[model samples]
Target: MAAPDRPAGGGRMLTGVTWAVLLLGLWLWGRDITDGSGGPAPTTGDVAAVGRPIGVRLPPAHAPLRAAVPERVEIPSVGISAPVVPRGLDRGGGIEPPSFDTPQTVGWYDGGTKPGAAGAALLVGHVDTETRPAVFYPLSAAHPGEQVRVVRSDGSVAEFTIDDVQVFTREHFDAQKAYGPRKDGRAELRLITCGGTYDRATREYTANVVVSAYLTGGSGAAA
Candidate 1:
């Protein structure tokens, strides 16, 4: 599910400035999510035509399950299988991402909703490093209707069905649209990574690739 070539840069994959901006958006998203008014409903035109899959029959959302800490996340269609590590906001007030040293790891925002719970669970990873393609390098190629499986610490698997994939440029980012739950009371998941072209002049990715999915089915942990 890899996108076209995205040559890498010499320094960190995602800069602090970018994360700060994203954190600002997420901060507002958190407030909206807690109020049971999930920002705004997503529109097909809200996503780029190329990323929006049309005419695919999506399943009804499964009822949200008990909270469970995610241990790993898998996107079989994109060949992504990575460990989930809990992360918190950094000194800069941005949600910390997995370190560059371990590009294959996915960072989960422990402060937010857990994978199988009643709100949006966030997972972030690097698209590529300076030397090689990272775990989420193929993320942009993932289409709607795909599946994302999260193995939880409670020994249950939470299955989600992809509904949207968007590439939000830094110039025009809507925090609520990118991070808020699409619908209140449903278990939602968001896989995020750097996207768009890498601008050597600015030393940053021009956009972020956000894949949105909702719980469709899952097995509960043994009682």
Candidate 2:
């Protein structure tokens, strides 16, 4: 979640999306955060969007409004199969990704919208580890039309289709665009990681890879 250099202690009020990549580092093999350059991203505590509930999913067809929890994420196209965990902002206000020891898994921003629910849900992982490429190394190559599946708690998989694959540089990062919904009413997902070149001097990557997707249709059976 750190910025370009992601230096600790800058007291800058980065938009919600901006802070996510703003501080998640300390030798990230593949960090997730493009940059923090745009306007404010409405944030209400853990909820990334303002006025959202404790959890907002695209309303269940016949099930209760409260959806199941996310257990794991699978992207067959890129062969990313990893457990999902919850992440939150650190003392510095940057998103806190899972530790380097858990490189095999990804972290979901629990404070934000839950995956498959309404609003934009965020999932972040290391593109690489200190020793090698981590779970999200192939993120940059992700294209539109790919299928992203999220296995949830209530016995269902929330499937989303890729809409856009982009790389946001430190100078051009926008929190709202990165973490907001594509339309006024829809469920969206954001897969993020550090991309481009790594700056040894700054200890952070110059660009961040952001993969955007939206809930289309999914199977009834929950995994």
Candidate 3:
């Protein structure tokens, strides 16, 4: 994900032996994941990709925010339903991800817009941890029109529909685009995780898979 001090986020790691085994599996014909470049963790004001919109286009929402805290997040399409943890800046001033020990957890950037608020809300997770896939391993497969629900502590769910899911290389990561509003004044969401191939030399994925979505319907949504 393209955010402020990104190196501090997406803490998923693979030991040399583990990565080698995974790469060997890849060599036998498997999914292609890229190697990632080091950067500041993704911040809301950070991503803005240059060029044509790589994500799907969608209309803005007229709904207002009805909840301030998010509890759980569910993506039935991918069989993902996990706890949502509010994360803040790390010592390096980057968005921090949940510890790798809890690979099923997802982290939302507290400094950015809330999930149901009008703006881009970032939800980050690891595509895979050192030994296996994590909560967002299937994130890249999320398609347009799929539902992504965020259960709020207020007992309301903020629902979103996937609009776009694209992979951005670390070198070409547009902080503005990755974290920016796909459409002005829309209550949008960005689900990000490491993707592409792992680089043995750099010890990170080369690209990121970012899923863009917008508020659709939810009990917490404004009427």
Candidate 4:
């Protein structure tokens, strides 16, 4: 996503001002931090820790084995239908390229953390195409109480009810709020993507849109 900014030709300085406001908003929200260990390195002890809300102590980095990619993700309100694949960070910690051959994909922060064992499962997608529309194109328009479903390889489906949506500047990516401990400590999911306006010069989006929801029910297995 392009960072928010004024159009190159000028005339929309207000857009730049909005970006400034967003920056301030991010500072207030606190920045996200990547845990050095990607997913929960599950151990036998870690398996017992599962089912708790976010913030439970995760297993060591080498604990749990890597899970398979999700089969499908369905969001009725925004019309998002995509397969989930395991996405990890490149050497630089930026989003690695999507595995096109995968049926559906969701990224795991190989350097920062994993999902399902504990904490919030962080999933992200492109809101639109650089030149053509893509999945999550209607993300900014999603409302609270919407439904998001993820079917894992185990033939179990996890359903989540949208709690709220928030937009934050790239500089202010609040990891804790977006992927950190929650009040209820129940299993939760955080879907993220670029939003706001496009910045042609920066070639990045000005803001990130985060959709938060909690798991309702399913086969009770981790995806």
Tens-digit lDDT string for candidate 1 (127-192):
766777788888877878999999999899999999988877666679878888889799999988
Estimated TM-score per prediction? Answer: 0.87, 0.70, 0.72, 0.62
Considering lDDT, where higher is better, how would the candidates rank from best to worst?
1, 3, 2, 4
lDDT tens per residue, model 2, 10-36: 222222333355343311212222231
Global lDDT of each candidate: 0.77, 0.61, 0.64, 0.49
The digit string of per-residue lDDT tens for model 4 on 67-117 reads: 433566788876678866665544533445344233134443333323333
TM-score of 4: 0.62
Error of 3 at 37 (Å): 26
lDDT top scorer = 1
Worst 10 residues of 1 by lDDT: 38-47
Output the better candidate (2/3) by TM-score: 3
* Model 3 stretches with alpha carbons more than 4 Å out: 1-62, 220-223
Q: Who is ahead in lDDT, 3 or 4?
A: 3
